[model samples]
Target: MRFYGQQRLFELTTSELERYREKTRELDYCAERPEKRLLAEECREMVTELEQRKNRMLASAIRRRQREEIEHALDEAEIDAEEIIRELEGESA
Candidate 1:
């Protein structure tokens, strides 16, 4: 797909871009050594798994940050007594 903007660019999501970079790096590494095909495959699989885990962890971190910001804002606002009490209770518990 064509990514329309100021510069000509290939359309790729963040994950796709990461994977593409990883695949290219792996290809370059594998090309240097011709005899270790099995090891190369295993390493490539490990890299893929690691990248997937990294993405998942990053997403979780972003969500946690957003939740913290929302909680902070709620704490800052002066709401009804019931709401304030609920917030205090939630905090203590």
Candidate 2:
């Protein structure tokens, strides 16, 4: 997968984007070497950008259920990212 911009994420369906973000997060957490971690960090940043775009889309969504779902997904992604960061920090400590 291309890890450059939100444009790729914008092209994906919400579900696909979420899955991609989650997978990227997992890869970030599993990175074993410094170079791998650097690449993972880049991917994580892309996912973060995608999340921001998703939030903007969520704001303009008209459907209540869709908004709620996106909100929930955002919350989950934030929590997951935080946890992974903490885990990585702990490993380095």
Candidate 3:
């Protein structure tokens, strides 16, 4: 379902974040201070964005499951109502 796609995206984002962190650490040890700072800032922004995306995906998954459950409950209610009507009609005959 949609969860599967989101799960893949989550995994890819996590991997990318890890790579960016590693790159930042490597840059820290080198001579180019300005480049390192810029990269570090970019990495931080990416981290924030990815975190937000992950939260959204989690929320979506929860909402989807809840919707499915509600639909199932409604279907069961309708079936029960139909059975009750049938029983009432039979008794009247």
Say which candidate scores most in lDDT: 3
The lDDT for every candidate, in the order shown, is 0.61, 0.72, 0.79
Compose the digit string of candidate 3's lDDT tens values, residues 1-93: 266777788788778767776776776666267877787777768777877876787787889989999999999999999999999999999
Q: Report residue 88 deviation for candidate 2 (angstroms).
A: 75
TM-score of each: 0.48, 0.42, 0.78
Clashing pairs in 2: none
Off by over 4 Å in 3: 1-3, 24-32
User: Best to worst by TM-score, what's the order?
Assistant: 3, 1, 2
Q: Candidate 3 lDDT (Cα, whole model)? A: 0.79
Q: Write the per-residue lDDT of candidate 1 for residues 47-76, one digit (tens) a residue.
A: 676567656656766787799889987866
Error of 2 at 73 (Å): 32
TM-score of 2: 0.42
Report model 3's TM-score to 2 decimal places.
Answer: 0.78
lDDT of 3 at 51: 75
Enumerate residue pairs that collide in model 3. Answer: none
Candidate 3, which ten residues in sequence have the lowest lDDT sum?
Answer: 23-32
